[model samples]
Target: MTLIHPAEDLGVLRFITAGSVDDGKSTLIGRLLYDSKAVLSDQLSALARAKHKRTAGEDIDLALLTDGLEAEREQGITIDVAYRYFATAKRKFIIADTPGHEQYTRNMVTGASTAHAAIILIDATRVSEVDGRTELLAQTKRHSAIVKLLALPHVIVAINKMDLVDYSEARFDAIRAAYLALAQRLGLQSVRFVPVSALKGDNIVTASERMPWYQDEPLLDVLESLPVGEVSGSAAELRFPVQLVARQDGSHADDFRGYMGRVEAGAISVGQALRVLPAGHRATVAEIIGPRGELAHAHAGQCVTVRLAEDVDISRGDILVAAEATVEPARKLSADLCWFDHEPLSSQRKYILKQTTANVFARVGSVDSVLDVGTLSHGQHKGTLEMNDIGAVQISLQKALVCDTYEQHPATGAFVLIDEATHHTVAAGMIRAFTA
Candidate 1:
């Protein structure tokens, strides 16, 4: 088989998988990679050797392939977001396999933050057990809410381990119903459900004869058929956060100054009118330079330096946006946060908030409420947000930030919270619709 070149695979899809522990998140990914012919022969042989040494009655556990750490193998759980890459004739895919334990929910947030779609796994046989059913549903709801808050548009519910239930249609139907209810509550627009046995490799790559009663498309079929393109809202406005300022004084260039950064949203072209934030100065794009050479036009994903017609006071943390689509300056911000660190987030403690290339000193003004994933309700909380907990909080920034809605501009609306004393990232935040 020939390898796909980067330029040939222009369409790339980033996706993540989440579910309660032992829901087969890892096994499903391994099967997808294995059956899709993404794994190498050497890796396959290693896996075969490991499978040969398995316990007498236990089947070859595909999850073992992705469980990297000794602790993870011992516990049989994923603790960090394990990333895998694969490509096909149609598109290239980056899969983030995240942990399902409640304590590792923060890792889920980290993985889903950059994903365009999410795969939520559910075990068919455990859908009826009280503890099992409730936990699974709750985890699904939580994962869905976070993906939505980040403005992800697609979701695929993979009801795994169908073989354990004799590939029964009734079991698949019941689990599908429960998941549909949760998706509806969460306002998910693009959703698909598939019955799969990740361990047995049924309905994952090819249609399963064991489940002839089910007539829907297989999991891989659905993934390939889904519309894979740049999301719609991402093309709404033009916002570029200045990462660095380049200056040159040479024979070809005399006192040339440019702001270098990646376009956060929309498209930009030479001579496009730009409005600098905070300073509120208007200028025209004189030239757009990419790594290769000057470009006539640039889009959301490109990293390029922009030179303006006239020099304006611009600095790091400042945003240059289309004059017509510029947003209001914000001092106080409201955000949905996923606490990752072992230390609980405290409202009274100060932290640093990093937005794109801009790092600003900020403090948590108040802890609004913690979300109860199962009920989709909020509980009043004021003390601290523990690891893996999702909550809404208010933050007071030292300087005003120009930002659009998270749904409107994901790159600019997302931020990371760092502990002031330890200088460690403690949480990931999505800027919600701002409060007046």
Candidate 2:
């Protein structure tokens, strides 16, 4: 397989596909790869073999292409995020096909976190059918809200299984209206509704002739045209978290030491003044170093080492920021957390909080509320947060942390909660506020 470097191609777009069970998310992705001619011959042969093993007269199970795990195959459901890569002439794509079951909501969040766009699939036949037993509509609304909260720029609503509804425009319109209402409520800005039949490959790579009422671009066209570069531009505040301290000793010449890290936000230039946070010390950038040589400027997403003229106390977890930018350092934080582990999160329970290469001891200070996804309500909870549950919690860190709200800077505002005993990540959290 050829490796396509993301930096070399600025048109690479990372997106996630999410929906409730049987919405044809897996099949839609399979069709995309197949229609785009990204699937290999050997992989196609394997798929054919898997098809022959299935019961006769059944459609080729496209879900087989992504359900790689033994457990997933046996259960016939995607359990984790399955990453797939493809490229068109216009753009290269990396897609995270996440599970749709309620139990795997955390997996969906993980897949959607880094995605610039999201494709939400909905079965057309089930558009208006109310399911009070399962609260299907409520679940869909919750998924939409979470995706919006992550600040995804574009959302494509794929009304799949159009063939099952006999290509009814009314059905498609009804589903589109429901989604639009929910999107408006959640403050989503960009949304596109597409009617598709993944089984027959309609309105996927090419527009479907059966649906004459719809005139928008095909799904692939939308994917190819969406902007993939930096969304906020260079106006945001400069943020660089120290990842490693590099020191080189030269016997014949001079000794050099620098702080190395990826620029998490904004831009920086040589000789620009900066401040070391948590320590509140000031320094000047003596040199901006890269792989080739010194650089005059650096922007978000670039990995570089910076040498300061005056060496102040600097270490991993310390943040270097533009001197004029204001930052707050605190020991207590309020966060929106998505529990991922099987074990429940309890108040006063200690865990390791990892943020931008720094790990600190932390304890759950308070459990504010647990989100009831089905009711779209916040339930007052004082106990444990189970798997796939979203809740608000207060954490007390062992040391002061330099941070920003998740909306301001994702790198400094996000963290993983690690189990102290097993060293396993239990939850992912977005810092909402800090208490002085």
Model 2, position 231: C-alpha lDDT score: 33
Listed per model in order, the count of residue pairs whose N, CA or C atoms clash below 3 Å is: 0, 0
TM-score of structure candidate 2: 0.91
Report the C-alpha lDDT of model 2 over 1-436, residue by residue, as the tens digit. Answer: 3455665554779999998877878889988988888888888777776733232444456677777787876776778999998887667899999998988988899899889899998888765556622123555766786786677889999999999889999888778877776677667988999999987889999999999899998898889888877633452388899999988884545678799999989888888889998899999999999989999988888899999988699999898888988786889999988888998886667899999878899998778988776555677584668887788888999998888889888888889999998998899899999976
Candidate 2: which stretches are off by over 4 Å? Answer: 1-10, 51-60, 131-139, 231-236, 250-253
Q: Give lDDT for model 2.
A: 0.83
Spell out the clash pairs found in candidate 2: none
- Give the per-residue lDDT digits (tens) of candidate 1, residues 1-436: 4466766555778889988888899999988988899888787666666633232443445676677777877777899889998877667789999998888887888898888788989888666556555334567677778877777778998999888899988888778877777777778778888999998899999999999987898887776666666542332378888999998874565689999999877888898888888678998999999999999988877899999998799998888878786377788888888888898887678899998888888898777898877687777575568887788988898887787668667888899999999999999998986643
- lDDT, candidate 1, residue 283? 89
